[model samples]
Target: MFPFINRSGTITPRLALIRRMAEFTGLYSWHWTPAEAEAFTSHLRSGPKPIMVSTTRGYEIPIQMFCAYISDSRYGWLEEREQRFGTVPQQVFHEWNTVLHVAEYEGDPRSRPLHYDEVQRLFDAADGRAEQIRARRMKGSVSAIRGAALVKTLYAYAYGLRRQESRGLDLVDLRRTPTNRSWN
Candidate 1:
């Protein structure tokens, strides 16, 4: 009735953590609680060679996905778990326990787009800033104008630029593309 998420990139390491967690906690991973998962991560961090943030996040995702898979209502895993065992599975690996200080911005739901009035207000504010700078006889009128144009362009066309993308912009990026129409 469903397809598996084929999102394994580069490599998908075995869930060797399950064996480790079982050995560490003296319980199977299915029996381990959120606290145990947290402890496991903490243990990794406190080890002689600590893991990186990205690697830690990578570790958490598989465990989290496993819990999610078992607990999903449609899959009948929960029903089977409840019927056979007196317990139901829950998602133990969460934002609080896992690596949140990601070097790259990612994996957030699109929350609340700007309303029509809000969008207009933002563009107006950018334009107004440039006008204000010019009216005050500011030395950086050209910079302010460019800034206003940049803000408008970002909102209107080049939306969803990440921090690194914004920082990586150059004068060449601002150059107009060549039109196919013959200029001769």
Candidate 2:
């Protein structure tokens, strides 16, 4: 019944919700209940990987959509299920049980910026690659060394430049200051 699709013509997130709901409802044979919905949501939150706030919030959308779909009389889901299972599907993802999206940034609390040690390791790895290429006297050793150094510099400054901006940067963008320092 869900004809939802994204701009790319792929199945929308609603399909995943339907599949998960089916699993929880035992192929639509078992009567769907609030407890079952809660259990399903809890199972999702209790996965091995730590659940981010955004991910937890995203999980609610599909369930809410499904609940809305099944509960709406216009969909005829209630009557159809009543005929087959002698029970109507009720909305389970009410505000009381679902997490609300109140904050602008809902990322995982445990996520943080990379440590200096991690950045150092990244540069070391890049340098080691450049050195290896140089040692082998490869044809592209010069370009490889320059590329590695450029990448390390870009990352160190946390420029966060897009592909176009990085590619557009040229010698003209670099300026030498009175302090004998160069800036890009």
Summarize candidate 1's per-residue lDDT along 8-80 as a digit string, tens digits: 4422343565556567778655577899888887787677988765666777887787778767899777777
How large is the C-alpha RMSD of every model relative to the true structure? 9.8, 9.3
Please, what is the TM-score per model? 0.47, 0.52
lDDT score, candidate 1, position 58: 76
What ranges in model 2 sit over 4 Å off? 1-4, 7-12, 25-30, 101-104, 110-184
Name the top lDDT candidate. Answer: 1
| Model 1 clashes, total count | 0
User: Which candidate tops TM-score?
Assistant: 2
Which ten contiguous residues of candidate 2 have the minimum total lDDT? 1-10
lDDT of each: 0.71, 0.69
For model 2, residues 1-184, the per-residue Cα lDDT tens digits are 4556363443456576668767766746236677777777777778697566577667777666676776789966677778877887677677787777786556754555456797788788888888998898888788878888778757643444566777887755554656635453
How does model 1 score by TM-score? 0.47
